[model samples]
Target: MRSGIHPETRPVVFRDRAADTLFLIRSTAAASKTIVWEDGVTYPLIDVEISSAGHPFCTGTARVVDTAGRIERFQRRYGRPATHRG
Candidate 1:
């Protein structure tokens, strides 16, 4: 660690608009807004479109892509590659 080498970090409130959730955590991020937390303390407020609370991967709502099916369709449409002969 060195002096004057790290960004300042403080309690910041991240608001997940999609999930309507608020999380207070220490972060180096900055915001132009502020929010009063549950502890009655005002913190920098940063609004996010998505977070773990609303993300499909975190909420287990993600759909697995059918890569095999897509490959099959592509091959059927274009046929297999031709082998090169010298």
Candidate 2:
């Protein structure tokens, strides 16, 4: 480790506005806002559009794509026969 070369890493809060979720973690990122955590301590608050809190995979609400319909549309437009498999 070198001295005076590494970015400052400390506890920071990542806030997801849409989900209203907050996460406390160590990061070198900077923010202009601050918030008091549950422990009565203030930390830099970084506002993010999405995080694991609201992500489809993490929230278990992922959307399914209409693959069959898309394939049919593609075949019709390109004049290709639809290949069927067992």
Candidate 3:
């Protein structure tokens, strides 16, 4: 560990807006907001769009993409170049 070279780390509250969940973890991220935790302690609050709580993969609600269909659509749009046969 080097002094004066690393960002200060503190317990910060990350609020997942999508899932409406809160997570308390130590990080070096900056935040201008504050929030009181369940322990009645105030910490820096950072609002996040998504987290493990709301992610499709973590919740096992992920959908399988149709790559074949996408390829067909792309080919139909731009089309493939013709190759010359000698």
- Over the stretch 49-70, how does candidate 3's per-residue lDDT look in tens digits? 9999999999999999999999
**Per-prediction TM-score to the true structure, in the order listed:** 0.80, 0.78, 0.78
Model 3, poorest ten-residue lDDT window?
Answer: 74-83
Q: How close to the true structure is residue 4 of candidate 2, measured as C-alpha lDDT?
A: 100
Report lDDT (CA) for all predictions.
0.96, 0.95, 0.97
Task: Name the candidate that leads on lDDT.
Answer: 3
What is the lDDT ranking, best to worst? 3, 1, 2
Candidate 3 lDDT score relative to the true structure: 0.97
The 10-residue segment of model 2 with minimum total lDDT is 74-83
**Model 2 lDDT, full chain set:** 0.95
